[model samples]
Target chain A: MTNADTLGALLLENERTRPTKPAIREKDLGIWRTYDWAEYTQNVRDFAMGLAKRGFGAGDKLCVAGNNRPRLYWAELAAISLGGTAVPVYQDAIATELQYVLNNADVKVIVAEDQEQVDKVLSLRDGLTGLEYLVYDDSRGMAELEDDAAVLSFEEVQADGVEYGRANPTAFADAVAKVKSTDIALMAYTSGTTGNPKGVMLSHGNMVRTCRTFLENEDVRESDDLFSYLPLAWVGEAIYSTTVSLMSGCSCNCPEGPETFRRDGRELGATGFVAAPRSLEMVLSEIQVKANDASGIKRWVFNTFRDVAVDIENRKAEGLPISLGAKLKRAIGEILVYGPIRDQYAFRRARWVYVGGAPLGPDSFRFFRAMGINLKQVYGSTEVSGLVTLQSDEMASPDHVGKPCPGIEVRIDDNGEVLIKSEGVFQGSLKMAGSALATLGSWKAPDS
Target chain B: MPAASTAGEVTLSVSGVSKYFGGVRAVDNVSVDIPKGSIFSIIGPNGAGKTSLVNMISGFYTPNTGSIIFQGKDITALRPNERAERGIARTFQNIALFAGMNVLENLMLGRHIHMKSNLLKACLYWGPNQREEVRHRARCEEIIDFLKLNDLRKQSTGALAYGFQKRVELGRALALEPDLLLLDEPMAGMNSEEKEDMARYILDVNEELGTTIILIEHDMGVVMDISTRIAVLDQGTKIAEGTPAEVQADPAVIAAYLGTSH
Candidate 1:
């Protein structure tokens, strides 16, 4: 149980314990679609069999193109279940941007949504030596297209599996066992806003260890719902929604499209939140601006209480223990200030707020904490499958990004750059390892 | 050779093809005739259900009530890929290329229907099925040469410039070798130079392959230049349909715009 490296094994164990518990909640057509742990396990197994029926084997690379959704997660699970690597790309990326990733990873298979994605893959069908198949999720506008050989719908693949599994029922489990921790689980290309993107290779071990370490420090229950908004290609969200959701017995929720989180997060009441600092900043800023427009007594009380709490947190951050007199004053401020504040944001029982992707300001950190939110910073990389080290709830700091995570050896380099090495540090890209990665400080160049 | 359906003699027909979201018609009671090899254009302003109309025609959406007949077959209930299989293909309003995949892979997705073996055999890459795979690869290379996308053959679809992305999208649509090609705002968000390139590619597709084109375009200049016949849609309803000159002179189309202008 402690040394589980394979994702397929980890999921099987959890399914046994909480078979009926919800595992995935994907928003489809303005509704949240729930898949329980048992159902999800079957889905992964069936999808893996389908992949094998579609000619996918151990060590295959599958490019998944879609927003944060359950099917996208299923694609990852299914791909992994068959000992294949899943490469998730941002849905908004243009055809040109995907060209490098497709070429470099030599993505043999693509699982995509809608005509938009299908068309893009079609555009680049010229020189791709490895790419041979496209499995689309949506049949919209695509019913006229036949799945003869190189392309298929996700459902068609599953149907093929019905007969395929009958022919070789144990093939899926065998492929799962054949998957070594050293084999790549996912390849995330760094957003190449600047130059060609570089693919960051993350192994099964790197991903599994990250999820385990984060869960060991914080308790996330089966009841907790995590809203997935960020691109799955991004490490922060993938860890929280994909890896962490698998490690901790929790359900990961994906909104319908963009801004879906904002429109529906209140309804979801996500008990655990993992988002970038930008999202946190945006929400807080909006709340602050709206509060400013509030009339009379409400505005006045909010201001006065917030002012007192901010001052107290600032003093504490500066290493000052509140005097007995100050502690009493702080308790009064907590009742007046923090309680109502937390209530407004629906953080009543919110267990964790993880902010990463960029440095979170000290002021924002203190403000969130003052409101009883255990907002912590997690420092990570896509290559590390999300976190290398994360701030604990007790010792969460804005200025410093907490201690080294379990199983990792961390050191500050000569150039004052943070260096992390562990069983979790991915073996790097399968194509052009070492050279493809350019160490730009702690951040590596993304595969273009 | 697959028999070529003759030009501009009504190869495609839309009989009241419509769509609704929570019972509000994005496209309502819209029908048109597209002659084989004719360049037909649908013109409208933003939120006038222009995109929705194209979506229905491209098989992205099913008409709640109506039939879309393409190449003498009822395709109203057909899915996007099914439509693609019936020689009906489309480009996007926003270029939807698989950005992480390479240029060649994008083109290969277009030939997805052309492959001979089952997915299982293709994945294994063996024997007779492998030869079929090689044959398709060679065919895709030809499409790449025709589009002049060979230079960026191995480039990531995500990293390509905007114009090239749009070009690659068009190339993908052309790969289907459609009897009727639907182009949704193909020149939107492009620089003048890029638009010129797209216009040329559209002309080539229509002229060389004798493919019927149903295009939704906001750019009047490009629409007027390329379309043999034009249809005007305003507020999800078809206002007029005729030759380019006839549509340009129609009073109802002008009144629809002028009435809304107030």
Candidate 2:
């Protein structure tokens, strides 16, 4: 919980303290392949060294576009580890959308996922004047890729890094030692539902503080397992799955693919999970759809126990005492309904889950609570590294997105807009590049 | 001619393949180089001999003139089962699953070419057969899990809906663990949502499983979305072959299939 915590230092500490503990696991072809803290750090080192060999140095931006692969997360850390900034774009972004992000950031190197993304980048290469190299993760159909020097597979780069490390061992460690707390770590582009997207530049200190605050305030611990199926471009994913995992020494599991997410979750028995409101609604509606076609007897059994559980929840929330009979009925409901429902959705081990990005509907919120799932609402935008206020367990409500998290001060301005100040707040957006010097002048003044 | 078996190299190549039904030439000379781990689609109007080309690759029909090279091996004269043994799996334009069999059983049957337990061990249901069955069941479960068909694992194929049956057929083909998968109109008879789902699954099988796919479909939207490259077949003659964007822009393809409106 140091004030000057950087992601590189956090990872180094984790590697030194818990080298054998699982840091990341990816389900590939129906098997969970784990990389311990040592291996995790090694991969990051290799990636950073690889970039260094390719002329990627301080202040360079590496654009990442891919599914939530372990390599993508590590690439982000690798860039930050080398005093560079990582910019991740949504995997499904169209050509025009990607063009805006890449061009705005003036990214020199782009690490894409597969042939689909490689094609998109190559097609837009003529428009992107600054782009120099294209690093692809999956090499399928890449034989036809036209450019030789521009296109390099992830494996090829890693191999180059390994060779470079063999030739110069101390260089990698020296680079890591140079990374400071205030250095920009990653830039997250907002979804831009309203208008054009903006790149929010977050520092290493911001991520470390947000993760450390969340870790200390919540029930999360070293033993907690997180299923990181969310888009890597999202700030929440970086905070929870990457930074938090590094800070807490917990294992983060990447699902095999979108189709096998539920099965992967069940296999991991993840204790902590996070999602946006829309994702939660989809989960609840899927459950409702399944329950709608249930037979009369089954529905009656489900409903009777669900009522008991909901009653117990309402009484608990109201500060009223629950009777012994009601408690027994709730237990019965747990066995008959809640247990199976939770097991089916792979929420059996879910001790803490969060829904954010928008206010969740009361019906879905209450439904998860009634089923004894500790679902909470988190309130924040990407500009704050995705954590400002979080609903505490005892004060859980669908409407209110809870009190301010640790180290955050909130106020309402005369214009009726909520303003928050926190260590986790981003340095600024890339759009403010030209005005940075002017802003710094006023920022350093005692009275303005 | 045998080519080197290299990653991302041509996994299957059809060299001037021609097929004839007596006097009628069902398929004229056609050549396509299907790369490894790519979704290569064949599209045209009705009666375009797309199925005949698929049959020739799957060994359901022998080519009158040309050879099929797969992984550097010439397999033009191979039988269907022999081709299946060599890691070639395909689904039909029409549903070809056994209606009487349950979903699990149908999927398990796809592994028949891979099973090697002796008859005595299979009948005894002990030792090698038990271990083999367990191994195969686990593999089938992976396919089922991949396809999200947990609810219909035990239901008869006939009792399931059309879309479910199509998914089951895909699951069966996936059970074969093939390196090359041929899907013929996998989204046919499905609604928009189901079509989207099927398209995603197809992409998953191609990208995740690293399977080389040759697809034939009438739905241009799904094809354009899923396929890395496409070859247009108009009236049994190959006209254009390139990336989705290139194929979409090809004048011959636009004139023959997409029409002037597109």
Candidate 3:
């Protein structure tokens, strides 16, 4: 086993090697603020101190609810550094849903994104007596808010962090020590695609180990760029956008909102992208609709290239090399055909795409690859930390989950439920207090 | 849709054009010629088939019949991107700016039709493609300054107000540097002041740039003031076509307006 002790130590390692590299690019109001490796480590430190100053030290649990934004992530890393666990409530979680997570985790402090999010917390605050202070990041609508009941600005907290960090040097490290891989990092509520949302406690090790295992099989570069619009509270996004990004020192681009997705996705030209079937379906619909408006000559060219793409796909599907004639033709056609089409879709830099959240149709899967866009299906959940089985571009597997990730050992039980045992395997069961540390338990057969 | 097959001086022309959505015929048989520099206006009530007729011309929708002629070529079979390449640009019924992009980046999309380089050149960031990109960026900036969007140049379109967003959409259409500029209700939902501002901008776009202008507008005051020629459609057919005063007095136009609640 490659003994990497802790998540904080991993961050430190990346900091030393890639201090100047951008770790996060928060596209705010059209302005890109780069949080490089060095700055990122320090910001997480300050965030830990700030939380401590706000009365959340090691062993204290907190709740954060927000869309995919930089401050939301910073708050998470900060919470982690301070040895405090956090319950990530969905951004779209209504008052009752928020009530369940907050009440269950017995949250002491809460950091919300905006007034709308804070209102959700406030709606349930009467029931959540454990909640002490409400930290709101976006103050856009809060300026006119008449009720301050227990509200505090995120800026004010960060300012306190500056003062707190100055006074207590060992406070951050001390907080981090109590946070082992075995320590539960998040109480992610299940998406309930099948049933009601269940709080799945994932540990630091569960997250990092799964990420590292995937890394061993797939190639991820430090220079890779990503557009992280998926909900931070979703386990899928946390694994790809947060854990994987932090591990590789990759830059994560946060779009302004869902409305600006296509424009933002085009602008970022992200090297690694992941989405559910719906998101991919929406984009593909636009591409086809727009292509329907092409001129005769342009349409002809597009058809020829699409044919070439189909050939490429078929060859790979049959495990055959592209014929010499086809190769020569494609090289020539690239000038008149494929290159412009790829640029149009802004998939020029895309290394590979993962679409899970639901089953992806074979036609949908092959169409992207045929056109030289590497997209694959991944199967896993919040409990498994993103992907346990993912297909690479050249392999093009159908009807199979393909191979398991390096360290994640998977076995199908009699009930047909896949059980994964690995280095970061969390023993945190749903039956226990959701925020409790992982208990290192074996997989049990599901009850009828 | 008629083929854009006129032998000479045919910038954009549509003949025998009609559009049907299920049982409702949005546009009836219509024929029109927009000269190289003429300012054409398509006006009618909400269901007057003005926008639908324009959509046929801009290659957004293929007509169930007739042909659309542009610059002595047949583009009846052309798609929107092809129309874009053949020097046709258009705005949307609702603003369609890339909200994640700044005003500058939105304008850069206009030049996308003009970019000659491929993805390889872009990914490697070298060769003649790189030179063209830099050159186009300078041109885009010039247009931004001209539009007085310099202050909001760096701001994301999402952060902008509706009026400013429409202006950015206009700027994006302008970036295509097309011979034909199609403005789809560019002043829709704007207040009087915003309308005036947009009217002035549209006039500058047509006059200063010498670009052919085709627009859909509900505001008759704005239409009468700017349109060189006007075509009115009712129930998918051109009911009236003439100078502002002539079309304004046409019985068919008045009856169509009276028949529908405008």
Docking class of 1: incorrect
Worst 10 residues of 2 chain A by lDDT: A439-448
**Model 3 iRMS:** 15.7
Candidate 1 stretches greater than 4 Å from native:
A1-3, A144-149, A191-195, A321-346, A433-448, B1-262
Please give, for residues B121-205, the per-residue lDDT of candidate 2 as tens digits. Answer: 7999987789999899889977887787865677899999999999999999999999999998898889998998898888778
Looking at candidate 1, what is the lDDT of residue A326?
59
TM-score, chain A, candidate 1: 0.90
Displacement of residue B45 (Cα, Å) in model 1 is 18
Candidate 1 per-residue lDDT over residues A129-223, each given as its tens digit: 78988888876546446745777888887787767888998887788778888777888887545556767777788788778878888878767
DockQ for model 3 equals: 0.02
Worst 10 residues of 3 chain A by lDDT: A439-448
Per-residue lDDT of A306-354 in model 2, one digit per residue for the tens? 8888877777777899999998888888889999988888789999889
Against the true two-chain complex, what DockQ does each candidate achieve?
0.02, 0.11, 0.02
- List candidate 2 segments past 4 Å from native: A1-4, A191-195, A433-448, B1-94, B98-111, B119-262
Best by lDDT: 2
- Of 1 and 3, the candidate ranking higher by DockQ: 1
